[model samples]
Target: MFRVEEPINKAADRMLKTVQLGIFNSIIVNRLWTPLQQIKFFIPTGHGTLLGTWRRLAVCWFAVCGFIHGIIEGWFSLYYDIIPGDQSFLSQLWKEYSKGDSRYVIADNFTVCMETVTAWLWGPFSFWAVFAFLTNKPYRFVLQLIISLGQLYGAVLYFFTEHRDGYAHSEFGHPVYFWFYFVFMNVLWIVIPLVLILMLGDSY
Candidate 1:
């Protein structure tokens, strides 16, 4: 009687264990096959290829602009107070606008203009956005969000820090132009090549 009861109990135990595991797996499968999950994959990997390409291009563009800005900073540091004698495009423009007298508002205006321009250019932010979309990197999403916020922060800084004393006129200038240039320089040029590589299925 004991031996017969032992076999019956073991069979029941096995069935219960099997049923528990089955239920657990079913839950997992439901989670995996949910509409949200499918849509997430579909947007990045399937039907949104063009948007992905644009995003990659944006990243590459900003990277280049960042490099250019880095060079300009280095040059500015080395040549402090000694404006370049070169008649290159930027130099000529600087000369045209920068009257050497304090009453002319050249120094103050120049600082205000550049800070506002750089803030608009916000290379890091544009690159981050494109990178997030193209690579589908979750970290990229966080970085992109940070970049957008940083641009806003930069704009505030440009106004509060550089133009604090009301030395510069609080009127219409190149804010819109700066915004467009910043986006174009950082995103359009930088991210396009890498995006093309992705299209070709080559490792970046």
Candidate 2:
């Protein structure tokens, strides 16, 4: 009877030890799983894919305007004081479309510096957007969002600086063109940033 009781006692001890080890493993797994899920932050998700759909129109818009701002306007700002300087494509442009009592205000020292900075900034982003679009790189979603915010900042500076002087006004200037160039142009920067924030936020 003593020998039989000894084996039964050993068997009970082994069973209890196995159950404790299982509990320990379950606790460890739960703790590790949460942080692993959070690491998903680095990867693009549903909303990022959604924003990708707008790549054609959105990136194109940035690319085209960015070329004009970074190159065309940049060249003019560097040379002319927003006045009709002798003759050039850009100067001709200013003469045709620009309207103001002090049109030179657009290329004032302050405005020229801002445009130059924006030109340098937008040039790289436009290149990146085009490259990313062609490659279908998901990481570009985050880049797009970042650049969009920067664009918004630059737009605000441009708008307020222009506003301090005045908007383009002439006897028969089209409200349509004024709104298109000054209002809608800057407004898109603000709007697109918000859209990118919403759509690319999942990647955060």
Candidate 3:
């Protein structure tokens, strides 16, 4: 005789399917970006018609922003270099690591700072998209919710991961603007893309 399935096993399976369905739905809808307002919260009020015309442009703008960020921060290492110090941030970073006298949690992994900041900024973009979806189609909120959570996860991982905690603080002697500029640059870099998305009529 065939054995019956365990209740716990069935429940777990159902939960997995629910989560998988939610993620799948988010990806499908986000890629198509069809229901503009519902899937993209940055869509300002009274601009549904323009979404189609500007959607691709908006996406391209954000893509460019992302690429620029990667090039400057990831490739050229601008943020980690060219500061007011004689040595590049990475050089100091390695020096600190070698000397066993690190100060900040994010010191060792300079790249972590870049990743964390970018992810944090991108969270809003995804959030608005999900918010748009929820407002128009409450039933499909689960999908958007999953996507938002994933974005959030990315941001959190960038900041709190142990590997990223290497250079949490700076050891340099500098003005407040030094730190402020560093942060502002990263924030603005990400904001531009988000703004472009909003200008195109995405809501949230």
Predicted candidate 1 versus true structure: per-residue lDDT over 55-153, tens digit per residue: 444354444434433344233323324444655543432332232212113334445445435434544445454455555665654554454445445
Report per-prediction Cα RMSD to one decimal.
27.3, 30.0, 19.1
Write candidate 3's Cα lDDT for 101-188 as tens digits.
2322223454445444544444344444434433344432333344334434543443354235443343222222123323332344
Measure candidate 2: CA RMSD: 30.0
- What TM-scores do the predictions have? 0.36, 0.59, 0.29
Residue 162 of model 3 has an lDDT of 28
Residue range with the least summed lDDT across 10 consecutive positions in model 1:
96-105
Whole-model Cα lDDT per candidate?
0.41, 0.56, 0.39
Candidate 2 — number of clashing residue pairs?
0
| Runs of candidate 1 exceeding 4 Å displacement | 1-80, 84-86, 95-129, 161-163, 168-204
**Global Cα lDDT for candidate 2:** 0.56
Candidates 1 and 2 compared by TM-score, better number: 2
C-alpha positional error of residue 22 in candidate 3 after TM-score superposition, expressed in Å:
42
- Clash list (residue pairs), candidate 2: none
- Candidate 2, residue 78: CA error in Å? 2.6
